[model samples]
Target: MRLSNRNKTPFYSFIYSLAGIILVLWLIAFILEINKFDVLGDKSWVLLFIPTVMLLFLYLSGRPIFEYDSDGEALNFRNCHILFLLSQNNAKDEFPKYKLIKYNVVNVLMFSTLYVYVSSKKSNVVILKYDLTFMTKKEIKDLKFSLNKVVKTNGETSKDDNTVID
Candidate 1:
């Protein structure tokens, strides 16, 4: 199975584009006036500054397009910012399904992260983090289902192989 947020790319792109337009308009207005209004006019700089800061924050923390594939023996995951131009935190991972031990999803404020625990050759467990902020509720549900299925299979296989009949 393969899952991705490519379908919503246009929507996210539009939002960022709109924010950019607003930031530009505010800059132009501020430069033209410099000092014009008489009410809250002295603090008009606030109007220009607030949106600029907000846009910056949104861009920095913007949602990334996420992709997951479980078609073969290995599980693949990839994440890259919707606006790839300024994308700095792109992440990708591929590991065998049998290595998957457990997974957890943490939601804080407006961000969600997926923590995958896998057994490594040298280490008992390795943790991998993936951003899930952009995934829809249904997508998240399906992802949880897939992870749970993998964990359950791992547990059952380990149990069966370790059992000794006398």
Candidate 2:
């Protein structure tokens, strides 16, 4: 269950591209205002602050947020779920020991949209959009089914009222 990925290079690249675009736009604006310093108005500079904050947020969010163990436990972003079990029982043969789940930008966008839609309807499931790219759609669905089965099996055993060993 260990999730491994090529270090955050690609993730960093995406962030850099996003931030660079914002920065370049800001720079161009600044350059254009070189001669007309006051043309942007005192409050005009405030506009750049939005992008600055957004850049910071993007940088922070883009960092690796989860790492899974071979045992199926995961260390989620913020590490509160370090002990949380993402899967039950170690993976069997033909299954990868570690799967790297990177959240693709497109998936992130979709997740965000879905989150908003679901939340508006007050759905019980809290969908966290981070690190969603690591697993393909099929893989994610399969993992969910497997974990549910494991939980159900364990739950039934715990609920049994009487058990005797010969």
Question: Residue by residue across 77-156, what tens digits does model 2's lDDT show?
Answer: 22111112432322212222122221222445423111100111354433333343433465445544544444455456
lDDT of 1: 0.84
Write model 1 residue lDDT over 1-166, tens digit each, in one string.
Answer: 7889988889888888888898888887777666564455577687688778878777656456889998889999888787767677777889999999999999888788899998999999999888888888899999999888889999999999999999
- TM-scores for all candidates: the values are 0.86, 0.42
Cα lDDT listed for each candidate: 0.84, 0.42
* Model 2 lDDT-worst window of ten: 112-121
Q: Which regions in candidate 1 have their CA more than 4 angstroms from the true location?
A: 35-39, 60-62
What stretches of model 2 exceed 4 Å from their correct place? 1-9, 24-36, 59-65, 69-140, 160-166
TM-score, candidate 2, is: 0.42
